[model samples]
Target: MSELAEPTVDPADWTCPAPLRDQPVVVMGHGGGGALSAELIEQVFAPAYGNATLAALTDSAVLDLGGARLAFSTDSYVVRPLFFPGGGLGDLAVNGTVNDLAMSGARPAYLSAAFVLEEGVELAVVEKVARAMGAAAEAAGVVVATGDTKVVESGHGDGVYVTTSGVGLVPAGVDIRPQRARPGDVVIVSGPIGLHGVAVMSVREGLEFGVEIASDTAPLADLVAAMLAVTPDIHVLRDPTRGGLGASLNEIARASGTGVRLSERSIPVPDAVANACGFLGLDPLYVANEGRLVAFVPPSAAEEVLAAMRAHPQGSGAAVIGECVAEHPGMVVVATGLGGTRVVDLPLGEQLPRIC
Candidate 1:
């Protein structure tokens, strides 16, 4: 009898990082659970998503949910121009959910996706979105334990809309929230802002600003992880998405019953995005961003957290933008670059509608 052939090992146990590069922008085929899908998950998703529960290669990640604590957050995505300059709706859905949980000082664990599709939509497009959602969840080390899909008449529903909810576990002794800000507390941004809003508007308005400007839609899990490592005593964490920094600060000020003072020079805005805002009569402060975040921390721990933020790739442009003040409680004041001051009030309505 011929000797039995050696048993073949499973691909997931190889422990080698997936090798995929030079792939063009995402397409419908990439979302299918075939070679392209595997490549996408292994290469882009697995690296940043380092966690034992997620690496199991199972349909759902089995999180030990009985840990220190849990935080739950949900958001609906109805952004027009589903496909944008730097990211599509798939990645945005994932990032938005992850950032919400991160804002609670929690490590996001599980996610649920609900899809509303317009009838006659291409199966290829739906598959692509599903694939992107799966890949995004894998990268964030979260799982889609459950999901639902509904089909609507062609004109009734937009092309597609996704609602995602996430649950996370907050480490013991972590207290990050808007109400924690004190007069001496400092404000810091994770990175450059306005990229996402400007990118989407660029595509919609068909205006090109001479150079390619893409959305900054990225997960803040790793960046938050690093910040927590340095100092878990953060005051607040928020992703300025729909309303941007102006709205976020106003919310925090009102929540904490404290006033905030910001310096225009300290905030970091890319020249291209700034120019776009100027041309369109848009204030960069109120423009949306997917990848950036704002943090409030005690004055003492501010430098440490800022250093940790700057060392990370996503927060390379991080800077301390402002500080809480005792005067003008529940308001935000901005010291302009031209030796003037202005109230950075929340816009009564959407400044750049559908930009997110």
Candidate 2:
């Protein structure tokens, strides 16, 4: 055989693939916890990190350290207006990370908060936020172990941005994750949805619905503990945060390769939220929630788990909204009140940005 010459390549010929290539720059959707967010992590961050733990893509990374299982998670809060109806940036920061750890069947124990403050921001504002953080940490039964502060030039940053990292211990025999969702599992939401997004929007836009909607920005570690008390075999747990219930269900379906079917009537949408969304031309399903969670439990244990959730204050509105199915794996379908079925795809981006 004749020898062949080596092929020549040009470095300038390279280009990023579709979606990301289309944008060519970071956009709000990249951080919206939607399809764009997933793509960014899968196409960019995941390959760069090249770790199996990160590949799992759970809300928190479960690590085995010194013969103990720990769940670690971090989140940043850049919510505008700083304060909202039931909570503010500080509590939101603490609760957000705590909830992420709790989703992995972990009992959150400690948190570290880092603050990025803008120059010329009032000292009283920082003090108020710090007090809120302290109170929220105490309420969640976690300590703010360590943190750092940095100041940015005026107008170069939001008044304040808080990033919180948390660690928690996962109990023995608990293995909660999205991939664990399976056909025949029952889906349940802890309570009414869309309040947090609407609450923030109402404040930001000064739009009033008939009744005031408060952000459901409470810690969910205790509620998760209560459900675990019922049974540790819970298949999956997700706190539908940035992308709301619709995005969360789609994520679970894709992760588990199972189809999720929801009942429109069964979903508990508060009247105030429904009215506000109607006025704003928004869907409640795509609105963000701070304290709510969606859980998948094996049918055999679903009733008891749901009962436990209901008995807890945070889950007083707990309802059976759906079930996982074998058909249409990796898709979510909802049965409408008018005898119709609609597919609920993962949102492309958040309807409300900087609300979390």
Candidate 3:
């Protein structure tokens, strides 16, 4: 038998993949809102900008301005195809920022939009996006108070990219943050998961799963308001967007220095989404969701908060999926359907990239 040739790269290196800290060039994972994304922020951005506010790492920055608290956030959308089943770039741009601000229990009021368009893109396309943005802002009760536009050379850019920045007023006595999660906090999810990621992937990959999968891209401000109406003492609120439920839970667990216990069967994963993910060999837990939120509420307020969520249109499918625990702090464990528990760790990178 011929001896195997020496491997070109070290086999030991392949055993454990390179960490984000060792990568000199920025990879797509850096933007994925997972372990890599967190590393990028902690190792690079956070150190460079060292401040108490940035250190909080909340979805929105709560600023004390003139004795009034303001929740501010910004997000960029580069989702391919621009338009997908149920929504488009404009909708994602507006709703994303609005939800971020709302996560902090804020009443979103103003938005600033910026666009970078390719030179060859048609004006009609731009107009369509603008109209969508306008309609979304209106739906969210926010205004596009200011905006800027720029056109890049045809070959130098994607069709279009939109960035939305928003500001909202945070009510007093409301202190929602990932770090607020405690052992007894009850976890709630707004609706079915994995819809948006599957919806976008189906369109982009031109795959048919025997059933239509539409993006769950809607403004969650009103739904959040409804929940707040029940109680402002909500411990934590997170919009599971890019990294999905798994990453969001991992982030919360780490931030609060608590363990998270999830019931696999309790998570609301639509049949269509489940089938699609099964066929695509993807995990529903890590799929992106544009419109859903994960909330951590104290046990005393959990019932009322969940009821309020279910009463809202956006939260009609809300469900209590898990709770925080003291065991295995900074980790997430799920009770599997097969009567076994499994650890759900943070994703190293994005599973579905270019997805808003």
Candidate 4:
């Protein structure tokens, strides 16, 4: 090779990529759905005013209060455009917090909404968003028990941002947490991955794909109830929202001190999503999802839990994509269709911004 020739790249010798770690202040990646977000929590937030609940970092904090178990969570939505195919920010706000509670094997019961509005935004827009929230809560059979609103100067805020907090009851004999994942646990995903992120990007960025992809933003409380019916001993349930399946699984691996092995072919990626991600140099595994969940269950109850999941409307497309392993603890690996193995690491930064 001549001195002027370009260097060859080897995909096999992969390393987790990120910007230099010496950044003094904040960058977009700090809010991005990846390692930077986790770092912010671990390095800065967790160490201050911390408790065991935040340390676990599960979907929601399962608390034992007054002899009653409760799952509590909160989420804020700043999705650009406010509206997209299949849903809007209002619906996303309600469903996101509800799903977080549901992941803890709780039946979501009530939510509180708070809004931050820009000064120049129209009243009609706020009502439309509020109406959407009302309808979504009704559909999920949950209630918006309370709410508050405030306004910001036009330039200081998005048109509208919503924050929601929820509380739900956990049934007796039901315990679920990421740290409970074990070596023989079966890993299941509720449905196709990458739809919600792509749906938002396609509309917000005006990217053209042949077919329209809709966001998969729906509530999952009932679907969780179905799985609990099969066995109350289920180990882990995590919604693959920000940072997608890869980040969710990686978190579980680290929390449980176990390894995760996935089959490339078994992980479902819709053709449209795959093409869009490939063209954009994005990995669907690392994309965001609004309505999908990943579960870890003991081998003895894998089939029963899978069947229960598939029987629910929210889980009709559920599939077993991998298993918890004892090898390479704290890492995730995929066996490719071409007979090669590759490591899947928690993304160092967000691949797409404001995806959820």
Best by lDDT: 2
Q: Residues 1-356, candidate 4, lDDT per residue (tens digit)?
A: 99997666564543444443444456667777578888878777788957667878888898889988989999889998899988999889989999999999999999999999999999999999999999999998899999999999989998999999999999999999989999999999999999998989899989889999999999998898999999999899999888889999999999999999999999989999999998889899988888889999999999999998888899999999999999999999999999999999988777887776
Residue pairs with colliding backbones in model 4 are: none
lDDT winner between candidates 1 and 3: 3
lDDT for model 1 comes to 0.80
Determine the backbone clash count of candidate 4: 0
Go through the candidates in order and give each one's C-alpha lDDT: 0.80, 0.93, 0.92, 0.90
Candidate order by lDDT, decreasing, is 2, 3, 4, 1
Give lDDT for model 4.
Answer: 0.90
Give the TM-scores of the predictions, in the order they appear.
Answer: 0.80, 0.94, 0.95, 0.93
Q: What is the lDDT of residue 339 in candidate 3?
A: 99
List residue ranges in candidate 2 displaced over 4 A: 1-18
lDDT of 2 at 21: 44
Reference-based TM-score, model 1: 0.80
Worst 10 residues of 4 by lDDT: 11-20
Clashing pairs in 2: none
Tens digit per residue, CA lDDT, model 2, 183-276: 9999999999999999999999999997788999999999999999999999999999999999999999999999999999999999999999
How would you encode candidate 3's per-residue C-alpha lDDT over 161-265 as one tens digit per residue? 999999999999999999999999999999999999999999999999998899999999899889989989999999999889999999999999999999999
Which ranges in model 4 have alpha carbons more than 4 Å from their true place? 1-21
Please say which candidate is ahead in lDDT: 2 or 3. Answer: 2
Look at candidate 1 and give me any clashing residue pairs: none
> What are the per-model numbers of colliding residue pairs?
0, 0, 0, 0
